[model samples]
Target: MMDAALQALKQYFGYDRFRTGQDQIISRILNGQDTVGIMPTGGGKSLCYQIPALLFPGVTLVISPLISLMKDQVDALKDVGIQATFINSSLTFSETNERLSAAAQGIYKLVYIAPERLEVSGFVRILEHMHVSLVAIDEAHCISQWGHDFRPSYRAIPAMIDRFARRPAVVALTATATPRVTTDIRKLFGIEAEGVVATGFARDNLNFQVVRGQSADVFLLDYLRKNRDQPGIVYAATRKEVDRLYARLTQQGLAVGRYHAGLSEKERAASQEQFLYDDLTVLVATNAFGMGINKSNVRFVIHYNMPRNIEAYYQEAGRAGRDGEKSDCILLFAPQDIRLQKFFIDQSDMDETLKQAEYHKLEQMIGYCHTETCLQAYILRYFGERNPSGCGHCGNCLDTREKTDVTVNAQKVLSCVKRLRERYGKIMVAKVLAGASEQKLRSLHLDRLPTYGIMKEQTQKQIGEFIDFLTAEQYLVQQGGAYPVLALAERSLPVLKGEARVLKKGHIRAERLAVDDALFEVLKQVRKTLAQKEFVPPYIIFSDQSLREMSARLPATDHDFLMIKGVGQQKLEKYGHAFMQAIAGYQAEQKNAVN
Candidate 1:
C-alpha cells in the first residue's frame, strides 16, 4: 500500500505534497469510505481523485454530467503523463467500445463517463464487472431537484452506485451548494464517511463589485471597452440574450465566442474547444458555461444579468481569480431582473410549494442586494458559514453610502400602497404617486384616489426607487400568485402605526466602481515612476488587478509586494523595484495606514 501510494504521488502527479483538502479526502476513499467534497472552484478538487486513481488497484470511475468537463480533465491528465480516458455520447460506437474494453482490462488509471451514457447498454455490466477502485461524482448537486441546474440523468448515479456492493468509495465534488443542497448531496450518496471541506465562500483575492440600473448591452459594452484585452466571461440569463450580445460584441471587433443551450452540439463543442485552447479572448455565454472548467488565467466574470440564486452566482463568479491573482466579479443589476427570473420560474412545471420556495430564495437575494452588510459576508452566511462583519473587498465595503432620513418618504409610500388598496402593480402606483395623468390610469379611476397625485413632491423615477427601497427594507412585500401584486409587508404596520421611527438608506453609484480616482491617480504616479525607472509599458509593469490591489492595500515591503496579486517570482524580480519605491513614498506621507 505504501509503495503504490508513493509511486502514484511521485511518478504520476509529479508533486511533492497534497493540496489542503486533497489528501484527507483520498485517505477516506482509500480506507473504503464514501466521501463528499463541497470544495470551492480552483480548490484542487480533481487532484483528490487523480491521485487515488493511481494509488488504488482498480480503475477509478469519474461520473461527470458535462462531456466537455470530462474531455478537459482527460486531456489535462494526459498532458501531465497520466493515463485517463472518457466514454460519452460525443464519441462514436467504436470509440466507446474500445474505451470500455480498455477499462475492463484495468489498463487505464482513470475513466470518465457521462451520467446519461451510463444508463445505456453495455455500461452497467462493465461497471459491475470491472475492478472499479472508486466512483467520483463531479458537480453532484445537479442530482437534486432544488438546484437551478438540474438534470434527470443525474438520478441514474445511485442506481450505478448501487450496482457495486463493495462500491468503490463514492467521492462527490461541487463548487457551490447551499446548506440545503449540501444536505441533499449527503443523503443521495448515502455516504457514512464524508470529507466536507467548505473553503470560505469569500474570495479575498477577487474584488466583488456591482453596477446596478443599466441595460445589459450598455453595461457589457462599457466593461469590454475598459478591459479590452482581458480574459473574461460575459454571462447572460438566456440563449437569445447570449446571441444578441455575441453578435454585437463581434461587430465591435472584440475576439469573442458564444455558447448557450440553443446552439447545436457541434457548435457548442467547437466553441468550447477554442475557448480551452485560448483561441477566444472572451466567451459570451448563458449560465451554462464554465462547469468544471480547468482554465486558471480567467481574470474576470461579468454577469450581464442577475443569477437565479447566490449558490449559482458564487459558483459562476468563483471561476475567476483561480491562479491567486487579482480578479473581479461584477454584477449588473436592474429591478427588472426579478421579473425576468419570475417569468422563467412560472414556466417551469414545479408545484406551487416548490415554486414558492424558489421565489422566496430570489427575494432573499434581492434583500442581499439592498443590504449594507458586506456582499461577501452575506454570501458566506447564506451558505452556512459565519464570516466576520465586512470583507472590505465588495462594493458595499469599498464605497461610501449617504445616509438619509427617509421617515417621511417611507410613510408616503406605505400610504400610497394602502390608499391604492394594494390592488395595482408598481407601474400604476408609481404613476399615481408621480401625478402622471395617463389615459389607461384615468380609465381605471385611479386618477381620483384620495392619495392619487398627492405624492407630486417625488418624481416618477424617485418613487420607483423608494418603492424598491421599501420592498427591500421589508416594509413592503411583493404579493406572489398568478400575477405579482404589491402590498405592504408585515413590518410596515409597525413603522406606519408609529411603533418605530425610520432609518437611513444607503445607495451605490456606478461611476465610482467604474473608476476609482484615488486609485487612478496612484496608478498614474506608479506608472510614471515605473516607466521611467524600467522603460516598459505601465500596464505590463502592473496589470489592472495589481494596480487595484496597490490602491486598496498599499504594500511597501518586498514580502508585502509578493502578497500583491499577479506578481510571480519573475515579475517581482524584474518590476518589483518601482512599486516598492512608490509604496514606501506613499506610506511615509500617510498619517493613517493603508489598512
Candidate 2:
C-alpha cells in the first residue's frame, strides 16, 4: 500500500515521495482506517487525501467548505490528468446536473461538493448509485463552533456520511486545530481517530520575521523594493487598507489588485485570474482572498496587521513557498493594532462574556508574535504537538544574536503587573518600570511601588522588550476590552505564584554579544574596501543592515558570507575581493591564523 501510494505521489503530484506526514496519513487512509491530519499550513495537507483518493477502489467525496478551494483542487486534479469535478454555486444548473449524472455513472474519481449542496434532497440520491470509497473533509476545523474560523454550514457533513449505504472511511484535514478542537472534530464526525498524524508544525523553509515599531507604509514599501519582481501577498486587516495599498502600489508602477468581500463575483474572479497568471505582482487583499489561490511561487507573505487567530495566520502564510523554496513570512506589528482588534471584538453582537473570551484569543495571538522562540515551534506547541529539536530556520533562530536569559527581567515586569493587579496595559506598565516621574505616573501613584524603577538601569526599549518577552512566554496575555488589560495564561498560575520559573528569550539563536569596538572599526574598513571594489553603490553591495548582520555572525569563510542572506550572486562576486581583503587584513593585524 505504501509503495502504491508513493507511486501515486510521484505520478500525480510529480514528487519523488511524500512530505514528512503525508505518507503516514495516506497509509492509514489506504488501510481503511479513519484518520485526522493536523498538519500545519504549507505542510502539504492535500496529498494525504488526494493520493488516497486515487489509491482507493472507488470515488472519493471531498467535502470542502471553501467553494473556491474546491474549485482549485478539482482544477489541480484535472491538470494532473485525474478525473475530477466540483459542484458549487459557480456551476450552472445544467453543468451541475451534468456533473452529478457523471458521478452517478462513475466517470469521475473525485467528486467535490459544499456541505449545503450535498444536503439538498436529490444530491444524496444521485450519490447513492456511486461507489463512495472515502469521505475527506478539507478545512475540517470549521465543524466546531469554537474554531477560529467556524462555519455553521460544515456541521451538515456528518449527515451525508451516514446517508451512504456502504460506509467509506472518514478523513479530516486542517492546518490549525487545538487538541481540544481535534477531539471535537473526531467526536462530531463519529470517528475514533487515535494517534492520528499531527505533523510537527514547523516550516524550516520559511524565515519568520515579526518587525515592530514600523508603520505599514514604511514596512511595505521597503519590503517590496527589496524584493522586486517576486510574487507575494500582502494581507490587510480591513477593506480600506487594501484599497489604499493597491492604489499606492499602482501609482508606484506596480501591477496590483484589491480583493475583499464587498467586490462583485466577476471582479473577484478577474482579480484572482490576474494574480494567478502573474499579470499582477502583488495582491493587497483581506483574509477572504487566499482560499482560491494555489500559486506555488508566492515568495513572501506579509500581514499589514495581526491576524485574529494563529490558524488564519498559518493558512495565509502557508500559501508562500509551496514549491519548497526559501521564503519570508513577515508580520508588521504595532501595540495598538491589538487594541483595534479588541475594539472590534467588544463591539460585536456577542454577550459580554463571549466577547471578552474572543478578545483574549486575539491577545494570545499577539503574544505568539513577540515570541523569541521559533514561531513555528510556538504555534505547534500551542496546538499540543511537540518537536524534539528546534526548527533552526525561522527568524528567531536565524536572528543575529541569540536572545539571553531575560527571564529575570520578565519576572520583574510580571511583578509590576501583579503589583498593579492587572489594571494597566503595556504603556502604563512601561512607564512604571522606567521609573517615570512623569505626571501620569505620579497621578496613578505607581511611583510609590517598591518594584517601580527596580529595572531603572534598563532602557525603555529594553524594559518594553522584557514585557513583550513575558507576552511571548505567555505568562502575561492582554486582557479585557476598551482600555485593554493584562491577565495571566492558564499556565501562569505557578508563574504568578512564583513557584514556576518563567522561560525567557523564546528565540532559538544562541546569544552572541555585539562586536567589540576594535572589531567594529575593522568591519567599517571592510565595508569601505568592498564599496570601492564593487562598481556599484556601497549600500547596494552590502547595506548597513547586511553588514551589521555579518559583523554579528563573523563569517570566517567566503561560503559563510555567501550563506548570509541577501548576498546574491551579483553582490557576492563583485565584492568578494574586498571581503577577502578585509579578512586577510584582520588576520594579519591580530597575528591569528585563518580558521
Write down the lDDT of every candidate, Cα atoms only.
Answer: 0.74, 0.73
Q: In candidate 2, how many Å is residue 425 off?
A: 14
Q: Write the per-residue lDDT of candidate 2 for residues 1-595, one digit (tens) a residue.
A: 8988866665554356677888788888888888888886667887777888887777899888777777666765654568998998888999999998888777888988887776576877777778899999998988986677778778878887888889898899987788778889988987776746888767777777787533457657767876666668999999988888888988887778889988898998888867765567788899898876566667788898898777778778888776555778888775556767867786677777767667777767887777777777777776777564567877667666434554466667777888898888877788788887898888878899977988888777667666665664556777766677776567667665667765433333211112345654566566655445532223334433455556567666767766654454444555555665676676677775543
Estimate candidate 1's alpha-carbon lDDT, on a 0 to 1 scale. 0.74
lDDT of 1 at 512: 19
lDDT of 2: 0.73
Backbone clash count for every predicted candidate, in the order shown: 0, 7
Q: Give the TM-score of candidate 2.
A: 0.68
Please report, as a residue range, the 10-residue window in candidate 1 with the lowest summed lDDT. 508-517
- Model 1 C-alpha lDDT per residue in residues 400-454, reported as the tens digit of each score: 6666777876887788899888887777788988889899878988788777876
lDDT of 1 at 81: 59
Clashing pairs in 2: 372-506, 372-507, 373-506, 373-507, 402-509, 402-510, 479-485
